[model samples]
Target: MDKAPDEAKEVYSHHGVIVKKLEKYNERESACSSSTFISFVSSGTLSVLEHNNDRWLLWVPEERNLSVESDPTEWEVVNTEKPKPPSINDEKLESRKIWINVKDLKSLQLRRNTNKMFFDLKDGTTFDVVFQHGDAQQFISSFRSFVILERSRRSRQKFYVKGCVNRELSKSFAELDLFGEQGNLVARFMKDLHDRPFETTLTAFSKLTGVVASGLSNTLRPDDEMVSQPSLQGDEYEVIPSTLDHPAMSLPPRPTIKRGDPLSVEEWMRHVQEDGSVIKVDTLLMTIFRGGIDPVLRYDVWKYLLNYIPYNCSQTEAAELRKKKIQEYQTLCQQWRSITPEQEDRFSLFKDRKSLISKDVNRTDRTIDYFAGDDNPNLESLNNILMSYMMYNFDLGYVQGMSDLLSPILMLMDNEHDAFWCFVGFMEKVMGNFMLEQTSMKEQLLQLACLLQILDPVLANYLNSHESGNLFFCFRWLLVLFKREFTNDDIMVIWEVLWTDLPCRNFHLLLCIAILETEREEIMANENGLSDILAHVNSLSMNIDREAILSKAEAMYMQLLSNAEQLPIMACVTLGLPVPPDPETGDHEEHLKLSNMTPSDDDEDAFEKAMSHTFL
Candidate 1:
């Protein structure tokens, strides 16, 4: 049966499995005119439980019984109905506004019943996601739907893209680009959540791997007016286009993000609060969305959000230790101010540190001051972002590049509270990179570099010879999650796709894969070295095509030799995501295996790297 009967009055999830009943069907010409009663099995296999009254039974995916019945108390029948899937006929994305109709339930049908969710990225590729929602750790234990959205050009950032939360799952469904008509989906799993959803989404898609839709014309030339507008309702805050967008053109049109865009953060929170699990959402996103009319008031809202996440956060008595640590940290900031450069250098955390500033030598005072204070319409926005992020992420004290991440979000969400919360959501996955320990960031760089070497020995050799073997120069690309590369709108698409958690978060490794893939032909021809490769790679900012890179990247993801255990690291490598790699063992399966068991090398290594380093 292609479609179920309308009278399927009952449905529920059974021990991570979905089960439903199809009511009477009195069709006279039907094949099973009398087989009326039907029950959803553990899988797609639907057997005849009770046949009567001119009806038939069916199930999707056809698997054996393994479903646990719902709790009696939780099983209640209501008048809610299941909607049909939407049909998009040869749709083409234009100017980056591929809006999925919110009120239309039919449009949300891209979810594949077989897995939690599916994405057909392009032509013939497909991907699967075991989505999660709720408390961070419980995410794996609880498989809510997830999806990643892409947002960047010549760079990348990933965001979680999905529908509004619904009653049954208590979370919204993620949307994805379906490909291959059927069965062709495959990409490296990008990210996982031990923190907020936005963090997971943002980290997974972080990349500076491709030429985004903005900043480049079809001919691979810099489009003079390529300066991107704000993501949502970015009209009022449009600053004159930065000279960075085009060197030759004196002024590019300040691309503006109009508020009229569907499902802005404002709408997301409203729907989030409407019906769903009571997630510990970033009050910042909420405040920004609520007070969008006057983004100037975001600072006030930031103070309010500072209330949402208690500064001295002691959720339990064990957390009291957190307060003492905070005091110790504040003491360090104070002590550092008085210390000389050499004195502070002794402490690894402050050595040669640059406070949230760019390393780009050419950037002028106008560049820094332009975005810094009241002159920058987004200055207040940036303040709220930096301040709230500082309060929210004490583990990673304020660092360079974080402002890049905040600036984009600030552009999209003028309100500091909202920007702060969205940034918090973003930082959940990224903050680890900014931490004093710096191990996660180091591990990610190494992992990506390793992937690049494995995937492209030629390029690896070139980079190696030039002292770029570590590929650490890509640090900026990773640090702000590629904010330095693409325009803000591009960041949204990249991020939305990443949030899905499909393939898993280490998806950026795929970017490394894709970058190598796209340049394979060129690398083969150029015979470049590490230094030459560095220059070539850096100069690719305007010559890339987002679609081509992603397609190649998706292909690379399918070819990589990843393991279930490596999925965590894989997630991190995708978007500057912070997957500590079990600093002890440098493994994940061991962590899962030893979760409640004895410590191994991985445990010791993690302890040594994250904790003992304090002594170092």
Candidate 2:
């Protein structure tokens, strides 16, 4: 490593460390490309330096003529005793140097029976490094001196840092007896404090101070009023005037909704005619909207929902369509499979796409039995489907989240041709999310923000005031349609419901609102900023109540309908409801005209147009 600056303090230094893997972080995209890859064996020196009162972990590659003395903290120049000018290669190597803020480190995983360690950062950057000389113990010992490291209970190999102030706060809160006899609330608060430091601090202080003020107010109240208000609730005791307490800020009472049982094989068969053509398509869709198809029935029902098999087709026609589709799929698959080594060598984009597809396929849903185990046939099927998709839709090619979208379909279909077509059908509805400019993704987030503002302004305002108005924290939820937020089976139900496009257009946005509503109190109580919100939202993966969220989202739709007359045109457009006539114009033509205008128009017109296209 380079010598520390005169004003810097060197805490630790180690030599013979090699960076096995390094990739740039992109929160929205999980796919890795060739440009981001580092050579397998880039030998370097790792050092921890304290500068400007903040510590940093840095790695610098070994350079000729650089030498270290017996003292670990000291550095010296050898041979010519003078530094040489850096060449083009040296500049390239210097750009690869790793410099990470110690505080930004989220967790570290030490591989068992090996000297390699994986470092994960809060911003999603990851580093795979191996100690070439001694083991990683020496570095871990040095790191413990700067921060408190605790092994994760769930993962024996993982260690995370805990701040001293957070630990002290937890201890202080645990000793307090003010909460209650059981102190359950205090225990919960302490646990939250330990998990999230800054946000928990603000929330705890806010609630505690409110309680203190409320107690003082209650003590000063007249005996007559206390006797007269014996049935008053805690919120009714507040004497403060706050905007959030205003009646206009309150949402409609949530309606109770119960989900139906899954669509069984018998019920599904009842809808089919002797010709194999489905009858009462609208009723069938409604049945699916209320309750997802049974897993055993998904193989047959999904094809119809995905439009892979036309509902109006007879048995013979459906069989013919299947044969044609299989042939077409095979042709597409062969396009890339037939690419010669020489051709791939020259076609960088094709090679990159193939490389990304292969990498993602190897890791996609590996824990699932259908796709697990080394050399699993399902893995190859996934790779083939994605590669075929690239040939089928060359413009869109393969994106990071595509694997997630296809895995379930392939597993359910258990056939490569059907899964490929089903994936294409599913992609048709969501292809906008994977576009190069990500215009659809941004529009979805904007629509989600708009909905939240109308449905729950209090939470929306909180987010706006805290620099989270963009709602980017919910990006993963929208991008993969909540694939990461629910269990495998639950995701299937959610996807089937969304595919129906019933109840309203962009119902998925309402789902986002529903989840936010469920998390509203905990979020406002424990989260204070964007990062806190993101972490809390991400930690909810696979722990969500799917049926409850689906029911709540549907209830929100009902609430919107009940208040349709008073809602703004933007809200109506977002949910695919009829746009109310403009009072002054006495018709909605002018609004539609404005909404259909080009982006080159003024900002207001552009926003209206964007909102109009949110679901389209």
Residue-level lDDT of model 1, residues 228-269, one tens digit each, is 433211114322222122223112222222222222445434
lDDT of 1: 0.36
Worst 10 residues of 1 by lDDT: 169-178
lDDT of 2 by residue, 389-470 (tens): 9999987788767889999999888889999999999999999877643546655665676577678888977875665665
Total backbone clashes of candidate 1, pairs 3 or more residues apart or in separate chains: 85
lDDT, each prediction? 0.36, 0.67
Candidate 2 has what TM-score? 0.59
lDDT of 2 at 612: 24
Best by lDDT: 2
Candidate with top TM-score is 2
- Shift of residue 125 alpha carbon in model 2, Å: 36
